[model samples]
Target: MPIDGLLLNKLIREAQIFEGEKIRNIYQPVNDEVLLQLQSGFLLFVLKNPSYLIKLESKPNMPDTPQNFSMFLRKKIKNAKIIKIEQLGLDRIGYIELSVIDETFELRNYKLYFELMGRNSNILLIDEENKIMDALKKGVSPKRSIMPGAKYIPFYKREYINILENENLYDLNQPFMGFSKISKNLFYEYIEKYDYISFVSEFLDNLNVYTFEYNGKKEILAFKPVNFKYDEFQNPSEGLLNFFELQSMNSRFLELKKRLEKTVIKEIEKYERLYKKLKNEEKEIREIPDLEKKGRLLQAYLYQFKEKTDFVVVEDWETGEKIKINLNPLKTPNENLQVIFKKVHKLKSKEIHLKERIKITKKMIDYLYQLWQSIDFVEDIETLMEIKEEMIQEKILQDKTKNKRRKRSNSKPYEFEFNGFKIFVGKNNIQNDKITREADREDIWMHAQGIPGAHVIIKTNKKEVPMEVLLFGAKLAAKYSKGRYSSKVSIDYTMKKYVWKPKGSKPGMVLYNNFKTLYVEPI
Candidate 1:
């Protein structure tokens, strides 16, 4: 969870670190993480993709030299003393005003505004006249120009319910004292028990870190605890950092997943469009049979037409139909007959070829759809990377941003163990090809029948697996196939000796003959 407005307000209100401390230095460790060394304590600011985070942390080690934003902040407020810190009403914006003496011996005030809105969060340094000195995210948009020397624009102008006022809770679009939606119930409970001012003051003074952990799952919250037993930490910073790490991992995973989804979806659409065009072209070749009949008639009557002719009349022996055929004026009747035979042969060949082309295109569409399903069902980043690499190998995914060659990710097959027998599952085509080629001939191979998906193998060590382990492997095969969400999926299993990758064939495309099919619902 994010640090909400109420928790932030409470954190700042109770923190004694800012009372009279002077800013000694500032450092930007990465694009999103920042460190502020004050006279008495260290403050860490993480303003990555998820709004912004502020915590009184230990002095972190700087990884590199300061960047442009850090340099600008150091130049302006390096040695300035903190005069006041305040939150803008009940909004998520906070202000840290500084007092600095100019080179000419005059004291000046600079305001550093911290806006914690999701995705749109920004930090701006404003002068006394409200002109922006610099912004964390500098850009010019229709609504505002976030750059140096532009007038600072406040986040919003809506009327917010003051926590201390006698306001109706139902009319509020947001929490009166908190930022996240999770704080709503707690706020109502507090309001029911005590007056607004007393409740907020008490809540702020007694802030604690609450973490819920069950069955290897974990989540951290700022204050309110649920019915399930949880861990309470006296230090909120530790809780905040723990939660931040989890959120950062989730954010990165989501980013990669979205990019992969877009790539696969676009590829699927391309193949579908091709399939439609080919189907239409196949319609034009439907007259091949009639053309063949005409060619045979002209050949049968070739000797009778000894002179040149503009047209020919022939009678079909089977249907007793008279057909008038147009011919080239400059050519003899035999020449016209030869031309008709050649045309018939060409059309016959082309029709056969076009039908095959349509079949191949349709098959490609099915494979791309299966790949789409595989990507949608995967949850691991390693699996996604492997799938992306397979696409790159097949020329399905093109990276427009890459100008130089980069090394591939070090991903391998997913490993599982059941009944002391090792089970391996391929995450993508590349892994599937590798596993099938390198495994022992006696090992068992498993895959979803009639679907594109990961290949599962059980290491037999020259020993046959029992029904229990075989069923488990089949379950995994179905779970990773195109029928992952469907019931009664058929899975095929056989020894490694029965499965073979054809020479010069595409990756993950294999041939198998001695396989047994089993039906089961995927786990």
Candidate 2:
């Protein structure tokens, strides 16, 4: 749910400590967000959809080049002292009044207003006369204008009851201004099960803001909801900031997942198309043998052709069958025979080249499939970053983050323990290569047969592995493979000694022998 006026009330009360502080610095973290640096702390105003205002504990990363409004604010009120802060009648509009000395050494008064209404949110700098000097976003609405030199009009207030004074809590619907629907539902539900008057007394007297988890989502309010798991904070902004951070991280993770998936899918389609083209060429070249047979027949019947003709009928020496051969009427019989032989020789050479190309194309398709399947198992942004780095190294993606230095995380195989045995499964090609090449000579290695998948290793410590453990390893191999959705998948297993990497082969490409196969469903 978006931050409503009631929640803003709690935030403003906690932010009262900053009223006497001076604005030290201002930053525009993003196009829609602004940060106000002060002697005590930072105040962040998010002016995008689902906008909010929160007090930050530490300084956030700032853009190298400041935006127009941020630079304007810096020049106008760099060391302005905050004199007062107020909310407009439980509306989602808060303003901070400041006093600053100008170049003439005369005291000037200004106010910075933060309108936290979703989608229409904006921040404006207004003079003592309440004329807008500049705004983060400028526009003209039907009711008021937000452009420079226009009168600043606040949102119209609606009639609301003073809940603190009124004892009767019934008939509360959408009538109470600034109270969200979720808050009303929560209060009504609480009043049904417990003593309403006593609960209200305790909630109103409580100084801390509360965060609760309901239906797998985090919610913050002035009072904690009963029967829900909650975390308490002395400062209300902390709880709200934590919720916002988690929300932002989740959004970033999903966006990264989409972008990486799109890149991998593009590569997969390219290889698939190439594989199809190679197979088609191979099919055309397979007709080379038929052409060679025709050429030999023409050579034997060269003497039979006396005049230039377009067709000839001859009997096959081996099969005693009559066959028809088309002749080039303008050329001699011997020349026609020579032409057929030359065409056959050229086709024979092409056949060999096509076969080699077909083989290489097939391997590329398999490698791409492996990369595509690995994206589904990524649970966190860090793992996705590893995959992204691998793609960049392979030249599949551009190095967009080359200028930014980031710490490389050590990629590890997924480890599981069952029946006194440890099973390791590789999620990506790099991890697969690491596990297969680094496993002990006697340890067991497993992979799904005839499909792109993760490599699974069972740590035996040179001891004999049990059949149950082998089946466990096979299940993991199938589950992480491209055939994961199949009801039954074939898993091939062998000793690590029997597995060897081919010379100059791609990562995760290996040859194995003396292996056993088992059929099982993915777990």
Candidate 3:
């Protein structure tokens, strides 16, 4: 649930119990979470995240490791005594005053500010003069900036108010808070019934904390949500922790998955464009045959042609047909024929090279397509990371961050058993390379022909591979390819010996001959 002004007021009230406690230690378990261990049992929890921010009783597992910011906090005021805790009206601004004994035995006052302002929440350590010493998140904008050594500016929406001003219903509630929309709507009724300040205080004190499921989303509320039966939690913090965990698990993974997909799709588009260019260039090469015929005809009629400075009338020796041939005017009859012949030879030369180019380009497109297909089959974060690592290793993805935590996992193929025959399907290009090269020569290698797909190997162990096993392998290949949703897919299979990788070929590119094709509906 969104931590509106009302929730922050409640949390601030809970945090006041730690006012006299001595700060024993500080820890940053995660990048966005902060823990303060007090001499009293009451630990001060401050969470500063783009997602949500709240002050609560933290029951988080402390990491054995600590971040640099955590260590800085430990050194600054390890044994500092908390003098006071205050909530600045209903602006979602909070402050914790600390008294630290200086080196010379003089006492110094410092303040830690918690601005739980929705997605822009921040925590700042400040001196008596409000000069920022440090911040969990240092935000810089055209109008404001939070930087170390700079005088801190208190974040306020409207001109600073001396007291609660009833300019509007919202303005009145802004100094206090409402637990629900219904409660907020009743603000006018309460205002007429009792004094404004007393009514607000009563509302905050009367809120009952509980946990409930609403619209299939786990929510922790200070009041029982209106229409749904809820599981009651004596401790609001524990329920909120569970809700945050369950909510963020799917969200974080899905966010990473989308980023990975964007990277893959960008690369696939490039390869696809190259494939079309190569195909178009190969089409242009077809005109070479007609050009060659014209050159041959000119060669036969070289002596018969009378060069008219710009054009020549030539006779086809085979058909005795008269034809007009445009000449260079600056070259002899033999030189003219040689010029046209050279042009035809050049295009013909390109034909052989282009055929090889078209082959490789098609393979590259297929390789990228297979990589795209594998993303949907990734069951865990581990598998997704493996695919990302493969792309990075291939120089297809450039790491933008200096601090990328890479967990190296080996290329592991999907293993299956069909009729006692072990079948392995490569999930990505790296795995495809491994599966093909490591398999026995006689192992049946299957792939969706002319489609971007996985490489499937049936481990026959030199035994007579059954027809049923081949069909199974074909289906596996199709199921892992771009044609998985198609009505029919053609799969090709042959011995591993036929699938040979040439030097300088792309990771999953291979040449295969003597392969038979089989039609199968992708499973």
TM-score for each predicted model, relative to the true structure: 0.68, 0.84, 0.58
The local lDDT score (0 to 100) that residue 267 gets in candidate 2 is: 84
Please, what are the lDDT tens digits per residue for candidate 2 over residues 411-482? 778999989998999877778899888899999999999998999999999999989889888999999998
By lDDT, is 2 or 3 better? 2
Candidate 3 whole-model C-alpha lDDT, 0 to 1: 0.73
Q: Which ten residues in a row have the lowest lDDT in candidate 2?
A: 156-165
Instruction: Mark the 10 consecutive residues where model 1 has the least summed lDDT.
Output: 170-179
Give Cα distance to truth, residue 382, candidate 1, Å. Answer: 1.6
Whole-model lDDT, candidate 2?
A: 0.83
The lDDT of each candidate is 0.76, 0.83, 0.73
lDDT of 3 at 71: 83
Q: Model 3 over residues 397-418: C-alpha lDDT tens digits? A: 8866549776587747899998
Top lDDT: which candidate number? 2
TM-score of candidate 3 against the unseen true structure: 0.58
Q: Which parts of model 1 have CA positions greater than 4 angstroms off?
A: 10-50, 55-79, 84-91, 115-176, 187-208, 211-220, 224-244, 272-313, 316-320, 324-363, 400-422, 485-487, 521-523
